[model samples]
Target: MSDSTAYTESAKILLLEDDLLLAMDMEDYLLDRGHEVVGPFGRLVDALDAIPRNELAGAVVDLNLHGELSFPVIEELQARSVPIIVCTGYAELPEVKTRLQGLPLLPKPWTAHKLSSLMEETFGATQEPRDAPPSKIRN
Candidate 1:
């Protein structure tokens, strides 16, 4: 697939994941793809706060964040018509199936390519966001 980072320049991405390394890696990955990535946020409140005020194009969310499932955030994103992709390592996919129906659910340890493509696919190329190489950008 073409590097989705090309579309990143036009999309404001909100990333909510608690795993610090994973979050940071994804943030860097998104940055490299040229999309505006808000936060690899580990907290629900922080994510909730950041998503609305900004002109969000889409998001990649962790199903479990700091012992809290992301149902509420899903609701908010759905309400706002913001596209979201779920990333999780837990086995409770069925439990959250209702809220996550029809959305991309990327299991843990996913490829950077998949991540970037999903962002581009979700938001399209209309809206744009700040793009630059993060301190670290993995191939």
Candidate 2:
């Protein structure tokens, strides 16, 4: 069996959602599940800045933020070979789909359970929870 404990302890997740309420809920959920939440960045610029410097295991990104397309952010994350789950309302937007191709798209109105399962599948989660609080870098 895989070492679930070690997996959870080391994985750091990036969250790039503009919705304040949703971001808070996601951050809390990820933190409760034992992973470090790198950012609940409300804007694309902040997310782009963090992605290159931070040691991210994976990312859950919203395609549209503050009425702006987040394609550049997605491209940067993809360039770094960071696994991404596109959590957005614009999943059907042909432009976005064409750009992303086969990346996982988890539509908006997501549940903690669904997000947790995705994390577990992508990066693995453990029974153990982290002691430090989840981080937030909104701008």
Per-residue lDDT of model 1, residues 64-100, tens digit only: 9878898888888877777788897774556667657
Which residue ranges in model 1 land beyond 4 Å of their true spot? 1-8, 125-131, 134-139
Go through the candidates in order and give each one's C-alpha lDDT. Answer: 0.71, 0.75
Q: Total clashing residue pairs per candidate?
A: 6, 0
Q: Against the hidden true structure, what lDDT does model 1 obtain?
A: 0.71
In terms of TM-score, which candidate is strongest? 2
Q: Candidate 1 — which pairs collide?
A: 5-33, 8-34, 8-35, 9-129, 10-127, 10-128
TM per candidate: 0.78, 0.82
Off by over 4 Å in 2: 1-10, 126-139
Error of 2 at 29 (Å): 0.4
* Tens-place lDDT digits, model 2, residues 1-139: 1222234464677888999999888888777766677788888889998886776777888888889988888888777777788888777778767876887777789986677677667665654556775544432
Candidate 2's displacement at residue 81, Å, is 0.9
